[model samples]
Target chain A: MTDVPESSRTLPKNSGIQEIRLGFTLQHWCLWQSKETPFGEFWPGGEVLPYNGGRADVSFFPMMQSRRLSPLARAVSAVAWHSRQQCGDIPSVFLSSHGESQYYFEILQGMAGGEGVSPSRFSLCVHNAIAGLSSIHNASYQPYLSLAGGTEGMFAAFLEAGGILLETSKVLVVWYEQALPDAYQAYLATSETTFALSMILTRGGGPGHQLRLARRPGKGGSNAEDCTTSLVQTILEGRRSAVCHLEQSIWQWSLDDA
Target chain B: MKNLEAELKQLIIDTLELEGVNPKDIASDAPLFSGGLGLDSIDALELGVALKKKYHIHIDTNSAELANYFASIKTLAGFVVSQQNKSTL
Candidate 1:
């Protein structure tokens, strides 16, 4: 923790067109799924560690404050709290492709029915509402960024975390998404179950597994793997390398044992 | 008046999503904001909307007595009753 890396570590050297590489350490991590079973159990060939499903232990916030948290928020807060207990307060990066879509659908439905929106519901329907609530309840005034990176949200979050690590000792990264509303299900392929994953990322040589992310120009494999679960399994199993293909880029995550 | 106070208490709890709180736990005369219950401005707005929808009462947002009207469950109950009486007359 005493060592600090230069801010230019992640800067692409060519400055024109080339592969991008960023490295960081995963200090502490927690994963929570909505269903009582691991998501991999439902979808074969992608088994990861089993996770429990239950109420998020957000007792840290008083009844009044905690009550406003939607299920997605609760899961996000639960993982964030667990990591904070292990790695102290730090700036956070929250990533979700569809943040609070279910809640948004409810608000829209209420409006369409002429029922008028509940002020409480309207207030918490924004994209960053969960992150804001978590930061408040933690009493953490540290800088936080919320992003909707679509298919590349996780990779984008890691890039953001890596950038922050260059100056700070650690950065908390929480990626959580809820089940998409049925109306939009036909258009996109996403997980039906809600899940959240949180981890502390530090400058290259922290007290946990070291990881390297390399982005190259080209298309990735056609087969789509659930990034969230696959990522958890990769780190837990200490896998050497895992690859994910975005629309025009190929991103590879590997253990930086060197 | 007592019944209205109880109903207002429930409304506050529901509107604010005050989990694990019983209506009886809220003191009728205690302050709702920055007092015993520790509610904030957001709760005030939410409670105002809930009160309006349920009781068909309009709370003047810019009125000088706004703070006094939302002072507590008792005050809210009294306000609702006054609004109802005005409509009837």
Candidate 2:
């Protein structure tokens, strides 16, 4: 029974359709994973999607600043920075299921070996580290939130992003997760390879795709893919919406392309 | 790899993941800490891990000379040479 933080648990239950003004795939879609079917196969239209993969280059971020990013953060950072580059400054959201479990793993290893923990690892261990670093690198003190919601983290983060969209015209959301190292393999599942998805969403696309979200207490959507990947598929295929049944509730994410 | 000084610079660049930074970019006399590379205590600790892993040399975590050893690329190589020599003997 992992006690979720009050901030995340207290998210507004308002259900509404959200608009994704822009769904961005990395210029480099290094989407490789060993979880039975590679995400590459489900590359949203299997190559017909308008947003194809490209090099996951971060020359945009200075090498000095990017040097310390974890694999998960690196991918998310690239997209986050890209979004900011395209939209100047705006509110941002970051969501991760485990939030740098490897950092925790390493710190524990140090403790067991009678060595002190690394400060860098400790600093980057928090769920908001990605968003925090993005804020620092961009010199933007704009509001941001980092949320952890297990399998539904991606959905929760986007929900918050939609909230931001209410106030601002756009919001940049970066969702990233990586396979836990070998030690955590027993304790955790979904230990797939690295995956990152970024989307710049806006409000009032006006008569485009109607987006809706509801928290009905039942199970229906049995999608096997991760939350973000499923969202990507939904956006790429122009689905009415994606309903992901998380641990405690079902999140119906609808995007009307019509 | 000929010059231990140059080799240590490469190692630092690789271990610390100084992206867009080359060995030549890191001055031998320049400080590697707060004043020079803008690296903090965390980066120093990571570099410490890299050194132990590569050279199998034990580092004195509390030695007074530790700061001097980590002061610059040249100083770090000198420390590595001493430690390596000590291990051989």
| TM-score to native of every candidate shown | 0.85, 0.70
- Against the reference, the lDDT scores of all candidates come to 0.75, 0.64
How does candidate 2 fare on TM-score? 0.70
DockQ of each: 0.64, 0.50
Q: Model 1 over residues A1-258: C-alpha lDDT tens digits?
A: 011133422425555658878888766677776766523322111222234445666777778778888878888888888888877779999988888888789989988988767777777878888899889888998999998875564788988887898789899998887668999888765666677788777887665667777776766542232565566545445455666777666676655443
Candidate 1 wrong stretches, greater than 4 Å: A1-17, A37-53, A220-226, A232-240, A256-258
TM-score, candidate number 1: 0.85
Docking class of 2: medium
lDDT by residue (B1-89, candidate 2, tens digit) is 23888887888777777777888888888999977888878788888877887788999999998999999888898899899999999
lDDT of 2: 0.64
lDDT (tens digit, per residue) of candidate 2 on A1-258? 112232343235545633223222222122222132323333221222122243245566777787788767766766677667666787877777787888888888888997756566788887788889888888887898887755455667656866786687767777777767797777556536565666656664443333444554544444323565556444444344445665555665443343
Distance (Å) between predicted and true CA of B8, model 2? Answer: 2.6
Best candidate, DockQ-wise?
1
